[model samples]
Target chain A: MQYTVISLQGLSTENCQLKTEKMELKEKLIASFMAFENLVDIDLPVHDVRSEAIKEFETQGFPSKRDEAWKYTSLNSILKHDYSVFPKRDNHIDYNDIKKYFIHDIDTYKIVFIDGKYSSHLSETTHDGIDVCLMSSALTKTKYRLIIENYFNKIATKDSLTSLNTAFSQEGAYIHIPKNKLVAKPIQIVHFSTGNEAALLVQPRNLIVVDENSHVQIIERHQSLTQNPVLTNSVTEIFANKRAIVDYYKIQNDNENASLIDSTFVNQKQESFASVHTFSFGGKLTRNNLNFYQNGERIDSTMKGITIIGNKQHVDHNTLVHHIEPNCESHQDYKGIYADSSTGVFNGKVLVDKDAQKTNAFQANNNILLSDKASINTKPQLEIFADDVKCSHGCTIGQLDESAMFYMQSRGIPEKEAKALLMFAFSNNVMNSVKIPEIKQRITKIIANKLGVNIGFDL
Target chain B: MLKINNLHASVEDKAILRGINLEVKAGEVHAIMGPNGSGKSTLASVIAGKEEYEMTDGEILLENENINEMAPEERAHKGIFLSFQYPIEIPGVSVTNFMKTAINETRKAKGLPDMPANEMLKMIREKSEMLEIDRKFLSRSLNEGFSGGEKKRNEIFQMAMLEPKLAILDETDSGLDIDALRIVANGVNKLRSKDNAVIVITHYQRLLDHIVPDFVHVLFEGRIVKSGGKELAHELEEKGYDWIKEEVNA
Candidate 1:
């Protein structure tokens, strides 16, 4: 197969050729490109954007080991053979298969994206205290277009994958909670990826705005209905205005063959509070990026993450906490329990800008390796431009405490039971941070199942 | 009843317990007193099945049955308890939960049913009261942030709850005020009976004033150099361990 390397100044894409003997994939990519051209106006201006994106894709070779962000996990195995980026819409998965991920009775606000396409049929349109709608539809409406155009793509890096997301940004969800108004129930957003013919790439964008003195909760669920190798590139941004409070949770429990690159961006204003809780249990390869920006005085942000990896899977969590104003505080605690021959990586950074005194920032990443083959590479960095700030970071990557394990085992607790008990205790430290009772319980059940412990929670 | 015949143990190839012999019958209290580095604690730990001690040559019999192959918990199920000099602090697990799990595990190993939570709570209440432990203290994490006196008292409380047939108190009287020592000794005395035996391991003879030992044995270089009635403890306390060194030399 012929290959072309596209380059545009500093940004570039590498050339690639089909390795598979199959001849049908060429027709699939051709058809997929044609479908994209048919959906959007192929005018001169739009053509330039598409050509630029494709050129970048060619030059970068679809982001591999050379890329700093994608160093730990290589997508070469994913694109090794002839995989179709765009396949005919399978539509074979029943709605019930994806409905199980939905959270019910959560403030009654629902936004559903089926097969990466926003579905109005499965969503609730009207809400008294919040505005929930699709970004694609909202962009067409003059009133909401201004907000979408101004904020979209502002918080993410200009990488090939993010650019591709914007290049094909067809459907997404936008939620705005008015000032002083509290959403009684948590907003539930579900992203479903379907099709088993080939590789499916789905990018779901979510934007949540909490005005001054407002309170809201957002629960995001990412799942792939098919057992095939699917790729999900998801980005979520949240804004907490002065004195506002926001609690965001992203639960990634997709198929084990699926890979995901999920990022959460949070901005906090004066006296505001923002927290993001992530529980990652599935996926063949997963990377999570959480960035918290404290922009006002007395603002606080916290990031909590728990990752349980087994088999030969790989999971990485990278976080950055920026203290831009004075008297801001941030804390990060991420724990991982790995078994089999899996690998886990955690890279956390905290930056205190100049004049941001009394910042009070702390970061800790701890890992428990259940098997000798399992390994973790954790790095916690702190950059302080201000001298009077209190900042500390620590990373620990080791096997389960043998002393503690022996202590438990000597009590007649079997080896497996003792290990599970210690793991449960290790995970509970982060799970307890979820203030919402139902959500906390649900997370506990997920951890219990992953650790092979029977806590007697009926699903 | 237990017997240790020519017990020899070492740590990292350094001989610590050499040719130590002792025996205890039911309803007998034997105090094994020794100077620092004389392996008094090693004897207690080896009996409790601590893995740090390498048994170079020894044979330990519990009711004439060899127990060298058994694990610590199995030995515990066979009625062996050791009051740690320094109890470990495990965070986020309440004392009640730790005790209940320990008790049920021992019971299960003995083919006994696990106690109900209510019954366990009642037992903990009674034991805490006997040890002067506050009700709220039982709800807190195990030994975390506990005072020295409280930790020692909690050890006694656990001893009361376990009701082992062979109890070994290793330095339980260390770092305690006169009042706290009196309270702890009183608890040990109250729990003593003919069905179970107590082994008080201490450097000082003050604890024996309360829980009197039937026989006091002075352990010198890992062997009992002198054995006598209650008067032996008083003599060691008054004349110091220098007298035992001279006697061994003679």
Candidate 2:
């Protein structure tokens, strides 16, 4: 197979030298790669892949507004910060102090990271029947080298951010569910930035593989512990083999000083199912790049998200579902509530190939702008090449239903609470499909907290 | 229990309710009969303190307390309820949960604690049973995918749960069939007491046949043109609103 370098706009060879002359962050990152490599196992077989990825990132620097995919999300403002690429020392956090961040109500396998370094004291890994450990272990251990070689950095796109993450992919959660095994407890991948530096930048890479006739559920989150500036460029690649079931949930409720760029790539084999739910409640800026590729027949892919933000927060969701097989189905539903000067964007694209006959794809995005200044830009694109396929997309942007507000208020609910209830109810359709009760409750509480209402019951 | 004096309201500078005056005492059932665009619904909405209609000059007194400046929820806290003509479908909120929030919020406004779960369940069971609603209906989303009759029935069910001092039924009989009308009217009749009043706003006399009104007022061109005993509804039904228009013109 021929490999082509897809350079981001404005970062071609002609401008690369000029861009490098400024000693931008991209150049800094590339210049520091040698030191970063020396700190890790440089003799590993994955070194060549890392070298290629950094070169790719050097070729395609930080994406700018000129790029079509990055048009709605601007990095010019965030890139101005002189981020500390590496932490000076290891940071320690008491479990009791940060217990609220974890879903403690239920038992879960946790792989916790502090400032991009795996915290063995805070994590609970298992090696009984499956591999629920760190990527560093998987990379160095002889028993897991083959698996890591087969799966790591396999499905991620060649985008600048993803390549940046791949270049420094030293520590993250690595889970391998063997064939015909069922993981009883859900696995939680949490990355906490201690803000030890004035401004910190972390890239965490996660890999999950569920073999044939296996099942697994994973939850991932990125948190910042302080008010200092922190930016996280994370990538996750999931593979579901034949007849496998995988459910992934991402909770993005960091502080206003934190920004995240999450890129997730999912590949489904024959008769497999994969679903990812993203709940983005807080953050200064959040950009989600979610792509699903159906590789075999009778596969199911689902992507759902709910975003509620206020203040100057910005969130953009760019999703694509590529149907490459016959008799497969994909569903995408996203709901957003923007208030204050917040802005939201939803760009969903579904492509069905000619050979993918009888494919069913559906996409829906609905937004509610609570303030005059709050706005949303939503677009749903469908490119269908199969004549026998069923593809539909719907997009809606509007304010809360006035009549519904009156109806609730007439029932003695205050206007504030009424608005909160309506907003919650508007996103409830996406929440109803949450299979885990604890996660659902957590989401409900976050929503209630964001809405500033003491709703006693689960809406 | 309720009084409206010289009420003039408009929306976007278009007069919808002009000089509407009415009075209702406890233990009295008054029916406001009119044709479409006669402002029958606007009267109900204004009494419930809907903000869409600007009341230019009016006094809506509930038990002699001026409520014109109160919010809709404040009015509700003062024991005033208005059953919507077109009940809004609140998706994802079960009927039981919606009532729980409403009842608890009302109780909180009254400086009372949340109603106990058992007590709330009991009241829900009793009210839902009285309205002939199925047990399964209480668990579904509030009014979403509900039949027109089911929507009206759910509205009444909410009214029963609240048990307001004054309940205004706005076009409750519009989309209901005869059977649904009988059931709804029976539920209303059972809830009516000597301490609470009912103002039935309808376009026809069919609903009044089930729940007899103590008095009937014909509203024309945003004003109460005629008022009489229950016989006025029968007369309007026989003459079909045109006669009332002619009488107002003359």
Candidate 3:
């Protein structure tokens, strides 16, 4: 009887309420659709895109904690708000202004993206060792489309965030360096968001492929031109073929009001090397997932990250380094500094598969809390399925050493200066991984400014 | 230059220094001799303001100024140096950087400007030679992987660089070969002057032969029960600490 009564009530009122909500959502979606239609020349079908997203959302239940990739970070906070998807912007972004964000050491081939769309007008080509192009143009080139279709979203899953990125995947960059070629210079990929449009969502996808015996360094940086609350969902995929060397860096320095969700997947072949460094400095809520797989013998992979969270910021880093072949090695180091009610979470896993004998893996996560209310949850796990492997993982969560602090204080460093010095030194382990001078200096300055200290390292 | 009046201290709940009294004027070298657990090291650490040890009842003065309330770094600025029995191992911090920080901090506390890097490097080189410390050691991490004798030599090198008015050598001669002892003693003797004093705390009399002390005090049960000239060290070495315990009780 109760079920019959509920069914009658549901049939009478559900259609009307559902129609009203749908209308509201459609109105907001139309505004964004019109904005993008006016801004970019690309023919991205907005109606089809929204219908596909709704279908996926109905099946996936909004990507909950049950999903392995999104376990540590929750999308519930974002889905709770009825947010309008942001439209693309056609505003002009000076390439010269964006060049300042590149790592200014060694020669570099740059691919610049303005307001979620590739800008070929701001890019240049060199005769040295590599080919760089915008992803949209690469799709039209026909020769690279097979490689793009094969590897795009191959390693990344249809988790809530990546699904969202894929659903709106419109613009980004593609970099390819051929075999036996040494680029000698780093490649800088700069993405800048502009315009006063509120509630904007930008999706930037990058695919970097280094052929056999090749070497390249790529730095991907994301910056915002305004303080509005924008949502950025980005995905990057990298392939390091046999004997190839790739050093990839991702820097997220967006406005404090923005939110970011980024995922990077790397695969290495025999004798290949892949090193990834991530620096998280901005965003109200940021989540980064980095996965590196060593699928061949003697391959080496290193993943390093440093995050500074202050003023009610929330940052989460989830990383995995998998050793699937014999004689492979992996090292991971991530550190965080939290102050002013900020929160940081790090969960790293180092897995050594069976038959991967003689594998060596090490992982460490260290955090220092400067304010009493700040908190950090760090977990470094090791799963060694082989008996002959040497694997160790450890995490440390503590305040600044009182003895070390007193030691510094006794040396006449004031209390505030002493604390800042220790905090800076703590992050030095990860900052030292930067190979470029100007980029390192800029990061150092940003860190100093965030901590309210003077510039001590020369850029 | 230094005065300790009835200094009593403890670690945790156990008392170590029991009503210790000592006075050292400029140009004097005093040797504190005792067996293990006799509180010789405790007295040195107490003077240097180590926080683990609590001062129960005591008064320490430098030039008639109360220094009992000062922190270790402040004590360092006031020209008090303690060569730790066991120097700490600090990784990733170079000896040069550590010494520069120490010296600069002391100088800043004394209302002095920071020293230029070049001049500081020069001073480090000179003092390292006097202490028989290799110049390359300054580039390495502070006391990291340092041998027993190397740590002692580094301590003396730091002392020579700081040029403190009152130097407390806490078992500086404990973990050294004959050669290292001679080098360390020579370093200390070279640094001695009329405007400063040195207090050498040791368990054995072998170190006193290299840098002879002007006076010797026998510390039994945390208090100095006997005092004599430098020959007192020879007597303590010959008869051992048991004889003094018997004599004091008798």
Comparing chain B with the reference, what is the TM-score for each candidate?
A: 0.98, 0.99, 0.98
- Relative to the unseen true structure, what is the C-alpha lDDT of residue A151 in candidate 1, on a scale of 0 to 100? 61
Q: After superposition, how far is residue A253 of candidate 1 from its true place, in Å?
A: 4.8
Residue A155 shift from truth in candidate 3, angstroms: 2.6
- Arrange candidates by TM-score, descending: 2, 1, 3
User: Which sections of candidate 2 miss by over 4 Å?
Assistant: A1-23, A456-459, B246-250
lDDT of 1 by residue, A1-459 (tens): 111122444223222332232123333443465577677656534345555654554444356556676656555455544444544553434556655576642445678776777666767755455787776665456666566655655566556665555555556778888899877777778877665556676767777778899998888887877777777777777888999999888888777878888877888889999999888888888888888888899998989988888998888898899999999999899989888988887888899999899999988888888788787877777888998998878777667776565454444444555566667666666777887777777777777777666533221
Q: What is the DockQ of each candidate?
A: 0.23, 0.76, 0.19
Local distance difference test, candidate 2: 0.91
Query: What's the lDDT of the predicted structure labeled candidate 3?
Result: 0.77
Between candidates 2 and 3, which one is better according to TM-score? 2
C-alpha root-mean-square deviation, each candidate: 6.2, 4.4, 7.1
What TM-score would you give candidate 2 relative to the actual structure? 0.95
lDDT of 2 by residue, A291-366 (tens): 9999999999999999999999999999999999899999999999989988888999999999999999999999
Task: Record all residue pairs in model 3 with backbone atoms less than 3 Å apart, i.e. clashing.
Answer: none
